[model samples]
Target: MRLLRVELSRFFSRRAVAMLLLAAALLTALVAGTTIWGTRPVDAAEQARAEARVQAITSSPEYKRDLANCQESPEDLFGPGADAADCRRLLAPSTADVVGRVPLALADEVDDSGIAVIVIVTVLMIVAGTTFAGADWASGSMSNQMLFEPRRQRVWWAKAGAALVGTGVAAAVLIAAFWVALYLVADARGIGTGAAVQTDIRWMVARGVSLAALAGFGGYALTMLLRHTVGTLAVLFVYAAGGEALISLLPVERSGQYSPAENVFAWIRDGGRVFDSSIDCPVSSAGCDQTFQLTLLHGGAYLAVLVLLVTVVSAVLFQRRDIP
Candidate 1:
């Protein structure tokens, strides 16, 4: 318990961690402010110009080419090998009318903008966790800490507990603040804050916190295993940013589920009526019209396995290798 407390104190003592927390809070507040500000009505002329731009894009030569290709390869283009209604919506002539909106509803605002908070929180937690653990190694302070308490595994557990507690507290607070701000904005914008909307907000907050904690755990485990904070960060950024191309290289159909990036979204969207179709044809050339095919339990299990494997490896390394 003393070691854990010391670890937590060391974590909070870092200026970078404080800055990261500050940055996360400021950015979340900015998101809320922008979301509220976004509700302000646009001028008629501006709305007209936006509608015209959509009309132009829908009718553009490039869009026509894609539509022609989609018609030729509808299944390959979207999913189920053909008849992707959602995909077809994009190519349809009525898309311009579909794109134009006079008033954004409260539900729509939450659905559209709440995703940003999830993304920001998850990524922030991952980076913070990595640096939180990796900083000790980066500073060559792990050896000195171990001189005080030589049990590497104990140190590891302490660091993880500290990381998780930090992530959980931050996630809960930010998610609450974000939704509360959104709710107030929705009410002010003349949108009804109905029971259904509130229910959705509650669910979103729960998922956001879960994802953030998962990211933090994974980040800490990976950094501890490698003992190379910069390398861990680089790999994460690449996976988060360029994982799609790598996912494409996989020959398996519905291979998107194999990617952590996609599964994170799947975990967030699990059991929601967000996807138009749930059927996935991974064995067939027809695409999975489904949103992410993995269930929340499966995604959580997969992520847990990943973090567990890395943590086990990290523990072994910490025990066998000298801290440099």
Candidate 2:
């Protein structure tokens, strides 16, 4: 307990951690402010005017003709496999979109914001964890500390505890602020703040918090094994950003489902259909079709397994390896 306390105090005192937390807050505010600016609230009269214009445009002969032409056009002329996104874009009511007077903030927008927060906070946690472990070695402080404590695993546990606590606290605060800002924007924009919205909020909050915490812990474990900061961040970025994209190009079934990003997103989105999946038709599809890689519960369980594996491996290596 004393060791943990010491670690926590030190963790909180670090300038890097402080900077990371501040950056997270500022970025959240910036995003919220920008969102609110772009979707600023409109009076009923303005909404009516916008809707009227939208109706006129959609009902216009030109738009209707273009819509028809796009639907009936050949795929070879449009470049290839054009039967997917064309009609959906053309037919979706512009007035009902983000700039439109949509009643409720869509589930997808909430998921998008949640994913952004998770990515931001998750990387911070990983960097914090790596620096927490790597700094002592870099500064030649670990040997001196070991002279007093001697037990390397105990030291590792204390640092890990401190990392989790710091990250948990940071993530909770950041996510809460972002969610609040989101609803404020929603409410001000006259988007429905109804039961369904609240339910999505609840779902996102639960999954976002859990995902951030778990990913942070995983980051901590990886840093402990690597014992450096640069390599850890590089590997994490590749895993988080590039891993899924590279894998997605493969013509493999369910390719998107099993990636780290998709699995976490599966839980974040509550197992709803995800992005970059197939569309019903490129231009003239009658209906949209979608599928989930994993159910909500399964995605959660898979992530838990991943975090556990990283943690166990780190602990084993920490116990066996001589402190550098």
Candidate 3:
């Protein structure tokens, strides 16, 4: 308990971690602010402009020609069973379409700005974790710390715990703040988020926080193994870029299912679909689609396995290897 407390205090006291957390907060605020500003209720002037644009588009010769053709051959444009009524409904221009702006929607932001904020925080936390561990090695303080504690395993786990707890708490606070800001903005604008959407947002925030914590743990482990911040980052960069490209090149079924990025997104989004264009389709087979569903369970398992492997290897090496 004493060691863990010490490590936690050290983790939070690091300047690098402090700066990264501040950056994450600022970035989250920026994203939330942008979403609110961009999605603000369309003013009277904008509404009038949109209405004028819609009127102009509806009265245009090109639009008239397209509408005429659609009504005459609705099935051709809209597939079988599509009638002239469908053409009329689809061809009509609306002020909403012309304005191309929507009021703040919590549900939509969950998939958009929400995901972006999570990714940003996750990346920064990874760096924070790496920096925290790498600093010990870089400053040759690991040797001194070990001289005091002597039990390498305890030290290892203490640092890992500190990284995980610190990163997770930071992520949760920032993500919750982001959501609160958006929600308040929406409420002030008379927009209501559905109960279902609120539930989804909560689940998303939980998953995002967990993902970030794990990522930070992984970064710390990798840095411990490599004993250099840049080395760990370089390795991650190569794997992220090269690994996906290599997976795409492999002639395997549902190649995209193995992509780390795809799985990460799947985990973040609960579940996601991946389209593998590399899948060879038989010419004789019609409507051959190459989309595959990646469940959250699959993504969660893959990430868990990967981080476990790295953490284990790193701990084992740190225990056995000689500290310079």
Candidate maximizing TM-score: 3
For candidate 2, write residues 14-79 as lDDT tens digits.
Answer: 887788778877887776666566555567877787788888888899878877777786363466
- Candidate 3: 10-residue stretch with minimal lDDT: 94-103
After TM-score superposition, the amount by which residue 30's alpha carbon in candidate 2 deviates from its true location, in angstroms, is 1.4
Provide the TM-score for each candidate, comma-separated: 0.74, 0.74, 0.94
> Which run of 10 residues does model 1 get worst, by summed lDDT?
271-280
Q: Give me the candidate number with maximum lDDT.
A: 3
Each model's C-alpha lDDT? 0.76, 0.73, 0.93
lDDT of 1: 0.76
Residue pairs in candidate 1 whose N, alpha carbon or C atoms collide under 3 angstroms: 75-81, 75-82, 81-286
Q: Could you tell me the lDDT of residue 236 within candidate 3? A: 94
Please provide, for model 3 over 126-149, each residue's C-alpha lDDT reduced to its tens digit, 9 standing for 90 to 100.
Answer: 999999999999999999999999
TM-score of 1: 0.74
Those runs of model 3 whose alpha carbons end farther than 4 Å from true positions after fitting are 81-88, 278-280
CA shift at 3, candidate 1, in angstroms? Answer: 2.4
- What is the Cα-based TM-score of model 2? 0.74
- Per-residue alpha-carbon lDDT of candidate 1 for residues 1-324, written as tens digits (9 for 90 to 100): 887788778777778777877788988998888766655566777767777777787778898788777877788867784574655575664523534434546577565667788888878888888889889989898888889888878988999988887877888899888888767766776777789777877887898897888788788888998887788999888876788677766765566666676567666765332232323456766654555446777667767787788888977887898777
